[model samples]
Target chain A: MRVLSSNLRLFWQGTLLSYRALFHWLRPAQYVASKVFMPLAQMFFFVFLGTFATSASNAGFYIIGNAIQITAVSGIFGVTMSVGGERETGTLPYLFGTPANRLVTFFGRAFMHILDGMLGVVIAFAWGVILLGLDLSHTDLPALALTIAVTTVSTCGLGLLMGCLSLITVNVMFVNSFVYFLLLIFSGANVPIAELPNWMQAISYALPLTRGIAAARLLVGGAPLADVAPLLWTELGVGLIYGLIGYVLFSWFEFIAKRRGILEVF
Target chain B: MNVRVLFKYWRTILIVAEMTIRQQLMDGFIIFTVLFQPIIIALLALWMLKGKGPDYAIFVVVGSGLTGLWSSLLFISGNSINAERWSGTLEPLVAIPTPFEVIIFGKNLANVIQSLLSMVLGYIVAAFFFGYDLTIVQPWYFAVSLALSVFAFISFGLIIAPVFVMNPGVRAWQNAMEFPVYLLCGFLFPIALLPGWTTPISYLLPPYWAAVSLHGATTVGTAPNEIFFAWGMMVLFSLIDLLVASRLFKLMLYKARADATLGME
Candidate 1:
């Protein structure tokens, strides 16, 4: 009982610390510009150009498609950049040096990333609906939330992996660039995966972005809850597996860097 | 005259350019990432078109070429800005006898030349492997479009360089600009394919005009009047961006020098 209480305290502390750091770093003006306004601008750009040419239904799909695309891209950026930035700022080491349980620290950081992703998605989605007049009736709120949860975790995993791999200062920029284009190509953000070559489709299927995007498309297509089961399961499985892998690798890397005194290289 | 000083500094610019190119090529990871982008994009295009006709190859070739060029320019410019600022080397450049504008111009010229070369090479590879035809309607129009496009993009790069210098942390923001540009500019597909509301925003970007001009030049077999309009807009945008960038750079230098002295105190 005593140990359980201690563990709970550690988790709460880690969570609080992570949240504090995240909010501190996010410049409110830039956050609004990037996560909110830019998406609305993009929606406007696409809507004005293609509305007359395609069916209204198709236009709706395009809006939803771009919305999800913006969400996922912003989500990934939020996770990876935050992780890399925290590492660069020497806060990761400070957190590690604390008496908190490593697992709590790990999960706490991932939870904060998930929260950030949710905030970005919510802002972008709200902007799309209100400012761009995009229809949101196609969304199955519960199912959509589930899919977002899976994607957030999965992306957090990938971000953690990148944070583990990169040197401190350059990590966020390099990882963001590398992953941004890869996700754009595979996730069918601008185009459908069916339109890609067979080999490219195969690669897309292996990526978490593909599953998340597929699930998103179904939700936005007004499909019933059952229709998105396969995607949900795949995304969930991938998210869990990647999340575990990322946690282990990040913790191991942290340990190694600490022992080798390379943590100060930044 | 100060022409001798400019000439002397020009050698340093060349060395910087050469070193940048060598580093880009030798960095196996970055090379692989850069090379993979076009290949993946081409494959995606082939899948989408799916034996309908060979005309889609033209779209893939041009789109991938433009993408490669854009990526090269963005990567070099952003990385150069971030690297010089973080390494503290940019401070000394101000003390040199050469004018700052000349040095800035030299750097921009070097980056443009390197990016153009890489883009051409990538285009060749895509054409050879993917069966892309290299036909052109109006070579002069194409030439003009290319020149204007590079100038406009490099100007955009310059506009953001001060932000990068001030806060190397904002590299993510700089990098983030690529996707919006790629999507809205109609690189892989037509901007007409985007929804009606989004079309107007695409017009604000220089790449959209470049793409339209190129499409007109290649498909319509003449430089349309719109080409002149695009050229005019690009020149106007470049001038505005240069003015803002120059002012911001001056501010950055003043602050940086002040900080350096304070640190010594």
Candidate 2:
């Protein structure tokens, strides 16, 4: 019980400090611009392009897909930067020096981002309904919310892996932006999954957002939670796998850096 | 920058541009901006527009290329000054005998020239991979439009770089600015699809005119008068942009020196 309480305190502090130490430092104006305004602009561009490709009737498909995909702004970039930032800000040495539980520390970094990413998705959905004529008359509100949460967590899981890769790389933004844009293609955000070529489809399933997007589309089309539960479970499992891989990488990196006495970035 | 100054420092400008190109080619972010991002966007546009028929191949190629140009102009050229400051070179660059605007112009020139490669790559992707028999309907007119568009974009970029450096609040919106221009400028679609109020906004943007003339020249049956009007708008906007950028650079340099912020953020 003492150990459990101690770990909880470490988790909370890590979440808060890392969240605060984010590159932008959480200024409200920059936050809204990067998190709120930028994602909407991206969503609108694809929504319009999708409509132009097919027709206005298909706006919901693009809207829902993109609204869910917008979570990556926080999930990929935000979470990666938070984890990667530990190294960039010279905090990794202190972090590894502490006797704190690595599992709690590793997962704690993504805690706030999961919530932040969910809010981003909510805002995108709100914009969709307000401006783009997205009707939620038949959507199961709870199921849709769950979908948003799960999807965000799943994307943040991928971000964790990206964050680990970022620890070893200097071109983090390049990799982050590439994966973010590539998601717009492979995640069925703009183009339908069925329409993608066989190889693309294979990749689409392997990624996080693809299943979550399809599941959300189903619920929005009036399907029950039971119908999309498999996809949700699969999404959760995929996230767990990625998160576990990220944890392994983080632990291994710490061991190697300490062994080689290259723990601190020069 | 005065036209006379550009002519007088033509050799310096060329050297700066050559060095910038050599230096930035290794930068992953710049390489993505000038190359891969545009190609990926082109691929997405092609697959989305697959049902629209073969003629759209060239249109997607040019539109995605324009997206790259605007993105590079906004992000790369927009932050060019900040980049120098971050690297601790802005002060030396400013202290040099040569005019600061000339160096920035050459940098923007390098950026715009490198960006044109995205168009060529987009064209290749459409022709070879997508198997679209794409051809420019009016080669000579298209060439002229391309030249004017490059001038217009560089001039516009000149205004953007200093303005962003001078206004941190405005720079905060830089991420949100890219797609709206793409939407408003009709980079991927006709502005007629947007609401009526946005037409004037599109007309005010130099890239819209670039798109107008470039798209017009690429497709058949556009009136020569329409194309001429677009070219005229390009020349007009470029002149106005150069005028605005001249004052901006002067004021920026004055403020930076006065406040001792040139070496600061």
Candidate 2 wrong stretches, greater than 4 Å: A23-26, A264-266
Give lDDT: candidate 2, residue B42: 96
lDDT of 1 by residue, A17-48 (tens): 65556545455655555566556555544443
Question: If you assessed candidate 1 against the hidden native complex, which CAPRI class would it receive?
Answer: incorrect
Clashes of 1: 21
lDDT of 1 by residue, B105-201 (tens): 5555556655555346545654686666656667798889878877777666666666666764565454456556767788766776666887989
TM-score of candidate 2 relative to the true fold: 0.98
Positional deviation of A128 in candidate 1, in angstroms? 4.1
Candidate 1 residue A33 C-alpha distance from true site, Å: 3.9
Fnat of each candidate: 0.06, 0.70
